[model samples]
Target: MGNDGGSIPDRRDLVRTKAKAEQADKANQTRARWFFCALSKRRLEEPIVACPLGRLFNKDALLEFLLDRASYGADGAAVAGHIRSLKDVKELKLTANPATKGKGKGRGEGENEETPKFVCPLTFKEMNGAQPFAYLAPCGCVFSLSGLKSLSSAKEKEPGKEGSTTPEKDEEQLELCPQCGAKYSKSTDIIPLNPSPDDESLLRARMEAKRAAEPKKSKKRKAADPESSDPPKKKKSSPTAAPTVNPNIAATSRAVVTSLALEEAKRKAGMSDAVKSLYGDPSKPKQKETFTTMGTFTRYA
Candidate 1:
């Protein structure tokens, strides 16, 4: 068994290809991110969405993944754990790649025939995660930065019935999306795709300012005090005195009053002496209770 075309290779004898392996791994990762959905491991398709972490996804595929996370296997949680709902990722408005004739499969026989799925609708530039792109926050229409600038420049040069517009007017005006014609404030609506640190800071500041500008709900007022605010209504005096009763009627009224008084007196007479004492006669003097113990204790003893 001594070196018979087989020998136990020592660690030093083996080739140290760690650097090549790392490079290959990096290349594969880049390709995967650009060409495949990060969540589904399928070919990227519109409407594509990107998370805050810059991972790409197909919108429908992401939804499916969200609805049933177990369907994508154990790696699903690791890949799309951050996306709890639709708000976690922005739905990308992709510009169709004009160079891409059709959706051709990209493996095995026709690997070279595969074309980009989308491009900047303005300059017809390819959007394969390499170029600088932007989207309108209001309409979500994606375009290359250069293409957008060109379009803006063209707009500025276009003569209106009045004449060429001023730069100040341009800053104040709203920009309409070419794709959807949605009106968006140019100052705040343009959001860069895969924004840099500075761009993200500016976006955050803009968002804060927008939120601050919104009017807060005022507290509901308590019910009004109707009595306090209103003046007391003056009661009207009678026009004439009440007519005097006939002698016969007056006599009958007096008789009824006398009978009621007599009944009340009879009721009082039947009441207990203790109850009667509560309403004692005013003419009677209250009896003074003398303490006789001092005199009686010595004298009587």
Candidate 2:
């Protein structure tokens, strides 16, 4: 009778409903990612920075965590361990939302504190974790993905535009930031802020690729710079002797050093008993350096 008319709910059905109720609300989690510091869980303030994985954080909070990772408890390393230093993050340049500019709510004003403080300059869309947003690496200017895509498509629509030979090369196209006139490479310079896990993997791949290319570039620079090509030579000077002309060093420096050294030797050689007691005899020659005593300090014989 219960199976035919559902007079009583089964224990399995009850458990399933309970499990569904216990599931985490993803909307609040998404909002928290956009509005709070990833490390401190504090409301994000100015001078906000984003890591390569697209997690947001307050710069000060991240700095404190980097200074003493253990201070934030056992979870500190898990939160911001990727950020070894301030250089690991990019300071985001966010556009302030105009809607709440003059109407800033104070204590007891009944205005929701959850109101977004930033907006996309191109689309005027609030950056409340609803729309996908990205920042230009070259300029650090933030914008909504929709706004940026629309602008790019419109710009590329130009008839007979240079570098638009094929529509398939859209990702490789270059575009100027709408908020700032800085030119950014579409394929590389646009970094999504608070990107999803799938998108983060893609960003991570690009980051590693760029870093892999860096050493190659440094090697080329070292090869190109003639001075850096040769290893540095150690300057060797004898206390009693003058240095000969050295092409690697300036003649003036060598002459000054030689004159100073000669004067010191002469003065020491002429020292009286009282003054000479502390110094080694200048007339006697030092023993030749042996393999065993090569680095040992020697006295005049």
Give the top-scoring candidate (TM-score): 2
**Per-residue alpha-carbon lDDT of candidate 2 for residues 158-276, written as tens digits (9 for 90 to 100):** 66556447765666666778887888898788889889888988988887787668745875687646445433222233322224445335677778899988976887677676445
TM-scores, in order shown?
0.49, 0.63
Each prediction's whole-model lDDT (CA): 0.66, 0.76
Give the alpha carbon lDDT tens digit for every residue of 85-199 in model 1: 8766678778666545553433443553245667888788886656777777666677888888888778877786424667887878887888789887777777776566687
lDDT of 2 at 197: 88
Candidate 1 — which residues are off by over 4 angstroms? Answer: 1-34, 38-42, 50-56, 61-90, 102-114, 162-164, 204-301
Top model by lDDT, which number? 2
